[model samples]
Target chain A: MPSRQRLWPIHVILAVGAAAMVAPFLWQLITSLQTTGETTSVPPHFLPSWQWSNYSQVFHDTKFAQQFLNSVSQTVIRVLAQVLFCSMAAYAFARLRFPGRNALFMLMLAVLMVPSQVYLLPQYQLVQNMGLLNTLAGVVLPGLFSAFGTFMLRQFFMSLPNEVEEAARLDGAGTFRIFWSVMLPLAKPGLISMGVLTVLWSWNDLLWPLVVVNDDSKMPLTVGLSTLQGEHLTEYPLLMAGSLLASLPMILVFLAAQRRITEGIALTGTK
Target chain B: MFRKALVLAGVGALALAATGCSSSKSASSGQADSGPVTLTYGIWDAKQKPAMQEIADAFHTAHPNITIDIQLTPNADYWTKLQTAAASGTAPDVFWMNTPRVGLYAGQHQLLSLSDKPGFDNSPFPKALNDSYTLDGKQYGMPKDFDTVGLWFNKKLFDAAGVKYPTAGWTWQDVISAAQKLNDPSKGVWGIASPDWTQENLFNTMLQAGGQAITPDHKKSGFDDPKSLAGLQYALDFITKYHVSPTAQQMTDTQPDQLFASGKVAMFADGDYDMPEYKAAAGLDADVAPLPAGPDGKKATVINGLANVIYAKTKHPQAAWEFVQYLGSKEANEIQAKTGTVIPAYNGLSATWVASTPQYHLQSFIDQLDVAVPYPVSKNTAAWTTPMQTTLDQIWGGKVDLTTGAKQIAAQMNAELAKE
Candidate 1:
């Protein structure tokens, strides 16, 4: 067994780090239960009076259920698309013998260099021209492809043993068949990490949704919760309650995938 | 590192917002269209949203064929979205228009001219407010609600200091003396808090001194004028020279409203928009009085109001105009007033608003309306205001002489105004 004395310093450091991350969330939780008068008070209140009604108010007042569904739908569509399309593109860049392979791979990498914002307008225009504005499809389409996912998956596919693909080819299997059946199973960690990340990102996206979707009924949780903030006076209690409600699904997602997330980190050594 | 990534993302979003704007301009406006239209009415204030919803429901009750869908973008993102939408010629059919931006929007021909619309009236609201939306002698929107600056004070703090509450005719000298008597630093109490905000603090003082924010013709800034500089000095002295007010650093750490609510500050300059929040503050008794007269012996406060404007490119102009007419009508104003959400622009309804919340004498806001000067705006106010605000930040921080900062800001503003 490890000695308690030897673990003390490490324990203290981890505790401090954990508390630093958790304190803001705890404050949010406590603030969510306080009265607007109590929350906005000077010498800010630490203890919650446990007003259960703030949560109720969020449901009754705002379109919380509709927005929550929008967030879930958008995230689910984005994650599935990223895992499927990114893997297909990554496989082409990794093992397929196509002409101009180097040039195409280089072009894909160059896209990673350009900021994501450069595509916002053009993508928006494409969506607009397609007459998808203020629709669920508009929120999902731009998020369908991701450069980072392609790059990460391509590297992971490349890192896999070459012998497996050659053996599949020797068995008279086609390239697409080899990627789908043989190589994809080995690249699970990379796909899982990319999927996890895409879920987190698409769930929290605010600006793009606000730009394209003007209707509140169609907005995701991120954009919907923003309207809780007032012009001169923000009611912090209501804001916290709305945010807490919106973020609960994300928290559940992280918790359920906790072991896989850690495994992904171990294999990839990166987020 | 995370902050850098977020900044990069923000920059990307701004680029997207810009491109998103021009790409959609092809969705052009048409001549008066009608029938079963769903009018999207955008507003910024969530506090006033419920009242707006009530107004929308009432409009739907009358105009059975048209449906009013209320869209809310929080105040910060409201303008960015509006600007991009306006640029793309897809702005909401009718939206809340603020004073500073309406002029710019109107000048670009993005807003419909309300004067020509049938059954539209601007006569019920204050003329100063109506004139705020009028550009080149044509009204583009009908005024909704008006706000004027007043001195918000903590009665308990004044009582503890044995100082009398501020009265209607209080001058700058009276405020200064009272603040001096109320200051107690050892107790962590300040006589007053003077934040470097335009609407809440400095803008009213500038007007009280008979100064303007910009030239009437929108060609030049007034910061270089002697009267305007003096007005700015009066506001700055509360922090730089006097011991009565909290230092700039302290006010930055804590908002002036919080300072007052906490009992650390005895007084602050704010508008009636803050009334609900003040009423909600625990252990606080707050009331407002007219902004003190300036050294020039005239009391003027900035009178800015919200207006409802129709999108220039709207396919359903008739429905949008009908909604705007309903918004300006007395019934809607009364609903807005009864909520105590704002001082309704309609003259008689303001008394109902004053009576809506009687705990604090909100009548001070109404009394100041008589001497209310329109908040200064040029054809492109944001163009000049952005540069002036950046320069004024240094002056407010006491990093440069007020005069030098004023002149520098004036030069930048003049250069920008010349572009328009």
Candidate 2:
């Protein structure tokens, strides 16, 4: 609402900040369209020569299509599973009165303190014992349940008015009915936020997928894109091109769900 | 970031080692009775995959019942994945092994000994390369390829400076003077790129100055030795005293190899593994010369090589051994040489590698074999090497003096080596 003349400094600062945020992405786009040599050339090549073949080279060298499909399926399964399972666990912890419930919730909360890497080997062995190595289920199973998600959703459920659940109960609804038809719909924002997080994490996870899956065809986009990297000499152009394509879907998803994510963050006070 | 992952993975490896997962139950034993055997050959370099595939195809042609499957894991995650798989007892049947890891794997009894295998001979490869894979007088790997350090200079930069090209017997003084002449700060061109690289820069100079990285017995740290400090000083002086090379910070921001490839660095000490990158670089006028001699009037280059090793628990040991033997054969070396992927470890085939790319005088790498020393290591090399690198980084950053940093490194390295 301030005058345009008086707001110039703030506008300039925001513009500068926005440019700083965008510079790396712009550089990536430029590099993606350059030749391998030009990417490493000194006096750095600012303008790209539009070497679009770098993108096609990614498909030729790796099972990009299969991996993309793998990533999509794995992410979809992980988000759905985490939402369903975490919400169920969260709902019980939030409203239900059970024996030693506080102690049980505390035990679940303790898991959030430990680093995930400490669990990598044991989880791997479990998956291996179950004969799930190199399978999509192996990658998705460990990620399906997260302590952070349960805790976040639990807080959201607690913040909701107890009157709504009581009204559902008065209508002859039980705990399961109240959770399914009433509490879940009320906690939509928390679920949406948790779902977004799981999608991002599952899409970008490298170490677990790299460990569980050895076959390139079964690898997700993250692991498949890594094969384009060489030990001593990586073709930066190809890597950049492939990375751009790999990130495009996430960017599109973010755009499509932009309003919902911000609204979810506003309602749940979580990001 | 990769180094951080390596340290984490190293901890994971230690945990694995502590567990002592010695159950070598052949996971693939059931497949032994099957008709065709597909042995997985794990490798890290994507650039050499084609040549490896060619060798595998040729081996398959020879042995109709054996098929070799090449598994390419990029180097960054290779060791981590290998250790995880090893713990789970699903490691590849055969895989590429490097000098740093040979001792660790062999000591852990994870690698199969090739010494008593029929038709397995180390005579064709250099003794230094062969010795790298040997522990307790037992051969565990077949030498596949070797890479020696060379002084790669930008020809156009040398011409612009009106300096003569480096040759076979150039001394350290000659290198200093040439670097000084070629250094042009205004043009953003450095006389050299002297980053704290152990294999390419520091190790070569350390050896040239009559210093050993580790004792022959691999029981103590040699960084405390005065001769080794002298060699490191020679490389360190380039940045601190002469200012001919880029600052360590600059090199970190932009890798020294990238600097050299872009023609910003006049001279770079690197290995043949970098040749493909340089060859592919557009408008890069570069060629190699033997690294300069040290103050002791003797030349030395740290020679490192990769070897093909089979997993101890491989179900199809016979087929794996046959494939490994073929991989080490003259014919397979020729295919590798023709592709110019690496200097084939087999003696007398280096000429083919030198001739593979006629543009550069790669023979300089070959000629240095006479004075090449094996890359140094202990049972757990990374335990000491990682600390050595940290101290060197501080020294290069001008945060610590050479004497203090060297002594600190020596103390730490000795402590780690003693544990090993």
Candidate 3:
């Protein structure tokens, strides 16, 4: 155990830092319950007007329920695809003895270096050409494969002890068997880390969905909440309320899986 | 093998569903299909959304076979979304367009040519706006509404200082004299908020000084001209020399409108669009008046407006055109005008809009229309304007002299103009 007084100062510093991070979110919650006039008041009003109707207005003014469904379906499908596809690719690079394996892996690593915007047009074209525009699958298609996840999982797989793979090979286990059954169970932390990131990225993804879907029914929450923001003026109270409700699922997801998330974070420190 | 067959069946079903969707990709455009058709109309203004929705409902009642879906992507993201969607041929069937972006969109053939359409009419709109929307000899959009800049002052602050309310005949000299008396730092109030903006601030003043933002030819910038440099300086002098306006840093931290709403600024040079919002501001008493005359004894205001345009690649071009025509129709403008939502672009609808909000003397916007200068643009305004804005920012921050900054902008803008 550490000395109480020595650790006490460090604890105080961390607590303050934690509060700083939480303050904005707390302010968002308070602002969501405020009136339009109260929210914009100078010298800053701390107490809210308790205008709870702001939350109801978001539902009434926009197709928030449908958008919430779209976000969920897209994110779940995207996360499942990333986990399954990335783990397989990472396993192949880690354990397989295929021709051009090193070259293929390097090319994927290069994909991570170039900015994502460079591929936005081309990716959109490919999805559009597939006749998936305005469909839920269109938004999920591009996010399904991620180079960062493959690289992170590959590094984790490489760091694992070689004895397990050698033992499995001696028992005449095939590469698929080793990857899916033997090594996969051990890569749980890496998979969890990738899953958490994919969910976060896909849930909040706005630009791709905004471009792909024109109908209000198929839009994600980020795009739906955007309607509350107009050209000249915005109703801040309504926007804050819509966003708070839209962000609740993600917040709950992060809190419920926080311990596993922290442990997953430890395995592959890079996001 | 049985499980494999099941998996294959699932994949086959997905492929069929994809084909079903792709086949209907032309459904929004092609009248040959004869089924119920839906068209997407994209817009950016949140304040005008309810009225736009009402217009759409009215249109739907008349054209029962056609359904219009409204998509609002705030102005900030509207273009980026449009560009991406246009590249993939999935842009909204009809959308709102402004002057600067009109040239870019039309040049890329992203917008439909409205002139050749059967019922297309530009006679109702101002000739300047109609010509502004034309690019490469093709008219692209129909004007939806227009807005002009005005001097919006806090009546309470004017009364507190025992100063007379601004009249239409007021000059720039009158503004400086009144601002000096109204500026009270001890009470956290500034006389004006003169942020370095093109539309509502510097550009209009430049025209008042007999200077154009870009030459009529659109091949070069007019900022390097002596008269234009003086116009830019006059707006900046309120902060640097007169000390009556908020500093550039403060204006950046707090928008001019926010300061005005809080009763911290006596005057803010804003557009006609903010009239409705000002009416809703609790404690602040505000009204509009024409911009003061410049040294040249001339008054000018920057006139800009949104237009309703159709995507060139829309599957339902005929339906989309009907909706666009209706949006610019007198009936649709009346619905928007009666609510004081916007100054309808139609010729005779201004009076109704003026009466809708009787409290504010919004006729100042109409009264200045004779002296309104068209919002400047070229085939690629962003290419020049983006850099021009940055160079102007340096002057605003006191890093460069106003004349030197304008010259720098002219050099960069001229180079960008040559490329187009």
Instruction: Give per-residue lDDT, candidate 2, residue B226.
Output: 98
- Per-candidate DockQ vs. reference: 0.54, 0.66, 0.39
Pick the winner on TM-score between candidates 1 and 2.
2
Models ranked on DockQ: 2, 1, 3
- lDDT for A39 in candidate 1 is 82
Clashing pairs in 2: none
Candidate 2, residues A126-171, lDDT tens digits: the string is: 9999999989999899989988889889888999999998898889
Count of backbone collisions in candidate 3:
5
Q: Please list the C-alpha lDDT of all candidates, in the order they appear.
A: 0.82, 0.88, 0.83
- Best of the two (1, 2) by DockQ: 2
Winning candidate number (TM-score): 2
Question: lDDT, candidate 2, residue B121?
Answer: 84
Worst 10 residues of 3 chain B by lDDT: B1-10
Query: What tens digits encode model 1's per-residue C-alpha lDDT throughout B1-420?
Result: 111122232332344234433322214343455567799999988899999999999999998888998889988677656665565556789999887777666766778888877666778989889888999889998889999889999999899989999998899889888888898888888888876677777777777787867776778888888888888888888788787787777777777778787778898998888888788888898788988998868998888888999887787877788788899999999999999989999988888999999998888999987898788777666666666665666787878889999889888888877877
In model 1 chain A, where is the ten-residue run with the lowest total lDDT?
A: A116-125
lDDT of 2 by residue, B36-113 (tens): 888999998888999999999999999989988888888888887888888777789999998888888888878888
